[model samples]
Target: MPAKRWNELSPRTRKLVVVGATVDAVLRIAALVDLARRPAAEVRGSKRRWVLAVTLLNSVGVVPIAYFLRGRRPQPA
Candidate 1:
């Protein structure tokens, strides 16, 4: 099957793609910032591994969400 060029995509499709990409980027940035500020011991796994996964893996915001949900331990009030 032939791949469609950017111009070939419908306006709605293009808007959705752009919105998705923006959300992904925002989530990744938030995750990275949190990782950087939090201590290694506060994280569930090796901070290095989480950094690599969050930065490299393209999970459509899933990876970042996982990092926030499962990677870090709860902080004391």
Candidate 2:
């Protein structure tokens, strides 16, 4: 049989997971929107570069939060 719970997790871990998921979703959506609005020809423009950079930064930044979320949940003695 599969385990029901892998022990109780600390409050911090739960927060991290939720925040990471949320941020990642937001960044991915923004990137998609940016790509859809700007055509290939327009990508050379400064505005397009800025938009792409911001999207990339957000996506990369979310990794740390994900790690914290992945941390093992502590079990009560």
Candidate 3:
């Protein structure tokens, strides 16, 4: 299958692509920083799995959103 070139996209599509990419970048960065600051055991799902999900699942920022929405915060002793 042939990949569609960037120039082939319509103007509106190009704009949307740029905006979506920006959002994904911001969300991914936020997720990474949050995960880094959290204790391994503090993460709701396994720490390793969460990290992988946040970094690996880049489309529409689903994993990153899940981290923020679903990740459990640590309780202070």
Candidate 4:
């Protein structure tokens, strides 16, 4: 879905989607980080690189949504 669609959603819905995406992004980022720690000999080939690239992209994609959702939270009185 487009980022514009996120803006159209209700704050509650946007928060849920952003939080979910953030968690997903973190998990994928962790996996990518772990892959780097492994020895090159143990790591696979193009498959590993592809996974890392995709994860990086997703991690980047989650940032704006998360930021926008954070701003949507009601301030405590």
Candidate 5:
């Protein structure tokens, strides 16, 4: 969006946008850090592919959450 349009938004709207963006950035950073730390053998799918997806896909933490939940192997009992 244009800078003028952004400035025209109410303070509440600006605050919400900033908060949401900060949360998303934190999620992305955390996901990347986890991916780097996780053992390759523990990841269920292709590790490289998942890393690319979580890094490239900018969908408000959805893809990162999916990786943490579904793309990793279950721990041994």
Candidate 6:
């Protein structure tokens, strides 16, 4: 299907889209910052691979969420 232009979207649809994009951006940034600060030994897999995946994938928050949930090793109490 053809994509609708921004002006053509209804107010509710536009609002939803904007909110979704904002949330996705926030998640991505948070994930990236955490990845950068955390040591390599604290990460589950290759840091290079995680960087690529987190930066490149447009999973609408899935990739970032995965990075937080499965990528990092738990810190000692």
Against the true structure, what is each candidate's TM-score? 0.95, 0.46, 0.81, 0.47, 0.82, 0.95
Global fold similarity of model 4 (TM-score): 0.47
**How does candidate 2 fare on TM-score?**
0.46
Off by over 4 Å in 6: none
Q: What lDDT would each prediction earn against the true structure? A: 0.95, 0.52, 0.83, 0.54, 0.83, 0.94
For model 4, residues 1-77, the per-residue Cα lDDT tens digits are 54666568899998888898777767566555655554554434443664545455655545334333331234347
Highest lDDT: which candidate?
1
Superposed by TM-score, candidate 4 places the C-alpha of residue 76 at a distance from the truth, in angstroms, of 51
Model 1 worst lDDT run, 10 consecutive residues: 68-77
Worst 10 residues of 2 by lDDT: 66-75
Q: After superposition, how far is residue 53 of candidate 5 from its true place, in Å?
A: 1.0
Please tell me which model should have the higher lDDT, number 2 or number 6: 6
Pairs that collide, model 4:
none
Give, for candidate 4, the lowest lDDT window spanning 10 residues. 64-73
Writing each residue's lDDT as its tens digit, candidate 3 over 3-54 gives 7799998999999999999999999899889888888777787878887887
Which ranges of candidate 5 are over 4 A from the true structure?
1-4
Per-residue error for 2 in candidate 4, Å, reads 11
lDDT of 4 at 6: 58
For candidate 6, the lDDT comes to 0.94
lDDT of 5 at 64: 83
* RMSD to true structure for each model, in Å: 0.8, 15.8, 2.4, 14.5, 2.3, 0.7
RMSD of 3: 2.4
Model 3 has an lDDT value of 0.83
lDDT of 6 by residue, 32-68 (tens): 9999999999999998999899889879999889999
Assess the local accuracy of residue 28 in candidate 4 as a C-alpha lDDT between 0 and 100.
60
Q: Please, what are the lDDT tens digits per residue for candidate 5 over residues 1-77? A: 54658868899999999998888888778878887888988888777898898888878889888887887788678
Ranking by TM-score: 1, 6, 5, 3, 4, 2
